[model samples]
Target: MLSLICFQSLITLSQIWLLAVMSILWIIWKSRNDVKFNNFVISVQRAIGTVMAWIREGGLLIKAPMGNSILDVQILHSLHLKGIPRRSTKVIPVFWHPPIADWIKVNTDGLSKGNPSIAASGGGLRNYRGFVKGFFGLRLSIQTAFFVELKGVILEVSFAWEKGWHSL
Candidate 1:
């Protein structure tokens, strides 16, 4: 049955067809796992509902241009899936203040995929006029968010000391 659905998707080449086939397979796998591990059997109707929800959510990620393909529109309409919502165009202005004269400002930041995951640290030194003096970025192994943030500051301080810009 799965092979037949995949074969049909190959023939049609419709985005909806591919989405539906993948969603159906995912629902089946999830249902099987639930029954095997948790002794929970989901109803057929519930499984079908989950597939439909997945299809709708996946449809939003499709990047088809508007009104370009009638077949795409028909498929979406038939599935009762709405197009992606448009984002607001509002913009907010931001201003940055420079450091006092004869002093250097150090800015640092860090990011991690999760609380403790692959992380990166970066920092820059700017003079009173907001001119960049030095900058550094480091890709680190698995680390906590706090550790990465502190690492960025440490790197910035060490870099400034090496450059003889001690008035930070």
Candidate 2:
């Protein structure tokens, strides 16, 4: 149960870090006058949509017809037993309550740590407002963070559309 809390805290840091990178990326986007950010954003968004659709079509969920939700739980348990980041148990909390139709609330975050080069971002979507939804925490290279963040936004928007909610 507490592992979930640690996971959330890491995601928060990942969000802050991603924002900083996005600000820097703004400069990169500005350097190229012939190109627009929409190109990158759009490509990633399309990719995410396709991947999610694939998940649904292929039944990729744990104990759920669409996907294997328990895979993440198992991975987390493995990491915990292996003492990965053995000290991430201390993380500050942030309160959030997102609105969704048909009882959905999500909490997302980004996480990056120096040692062992871990960078991940994920969240949970819940029906009961207080329950956890889905989570993803991955060890990443610095360059991958950009890709991951982009996918994160893409996944977010795509999920909203799939749920017939307004994300715009």
Candidate 3:
């Protein structure tokens, strides 16, 4: 019984270690691809931190301390030696403002499935108090996102005009 328990524990520990290693490698690959294709470069520390968090979130390393993986710790130490910031926590919030007293604000949006696949456009008109005056949505045939977006604007404008909302 003791030998069986020991074997199971060893297997579990190895699995966790394997997951940790794979997580780091996967993150590096993804970050490399992002830099290559999107021109988005992330700091070494950020990449390690992201993978650490991802592994933790996936419950793969539940017993390990956050950001305490051996590889991540090593990379983080190197980044610190290079005087890079430990982490960047930048959050920008969006706030909506009401229209002026007599004017109604119209907001529109377009969504495409596969860049040039099925699409839809819709919009709503809101008063200064944020009350919805009218809203609409429609399915469209395959089209570019830009075209759908333009269609959304045109639809909103036509709707507002028909509703005698010229001040918007």
Candidate 4:
């Protein structure tokens, strides 16, 4: 019975050694062949690497931009605190994005009579020189705000290209 137990232990040790060697060989082969992993796995690895790289380089707060835009955002916050009237109380902050102040701020207002005084739809686009180039005002009812915003952006971009503005 002792010999049988010894034999079982030897078998187990051999199996473990075999697994170790096989894994080493597999790793070596994978390295030599440059094995391609599943796309999802590769994507996840890239995202993780990017996050790790970002952390290693610098944290978000440190890497954040220090520019006039930041000052403007701060001023806007201050204005809100001081109860100052400003254009459009709500804001959607898009950081690390290109500025429309340099591009073209397309101001828009609309009035439709069916529900309210949205009868006057007014939209204007600014050129690269920050001058008005194009204006669009559509008087319509039952239109989603999403649609108007999208159209405004499209018009702005279109005019920018038309006026030979380079998109960086």
Residue-pair clashes per prediction, in order, are 0, 16, 0, 4
Q: For candidate 4, lDDT tens digit of each residue in 1-168?
A: 223332423332333334445545654555445545532232446544554444323222232222223333353243232112223447888743324555655566544434433344457766556656677765555655555555556665676678776551
Per-residue lDDT, model 3, residue 1, is 25
lDDT of 2 by residue, 51-149 (tens): 444433322221211112344345334323111232334689997664654666645565555433456666556654455544445445653555656
What number of backbone clashes does candidate 1 have, counting pairs of residues 3 or more apart or in separate chains? 0
Positional deviation of residue 149's Cα in model 1 after best superposition, in angstroms: 0.3
TM-score head-to-head 2 vs 4, winner: 2
Alpha-carbon error at 36 in model 4, in Å? Answer: 99
Query: What's the TM for model 3?
Result: 0.46
On lDDT, the candidate that comes out on top is 1
TM-score, per-candidate, Cα-based: 0.51, 0.30, 0.46, 0.28
lDDT of 1 by residue, 87-133 (tens): 44489998878889989999999999899999999989999998999
Q: How accurate locally is residue 150 in candidate 1, as Cα lDDT from 0 to 100? A: 97
Badly placed stretches (over 4 Å) of model 3 are 1-91
Worst 10 residues of 4 by lDDT: 59-68
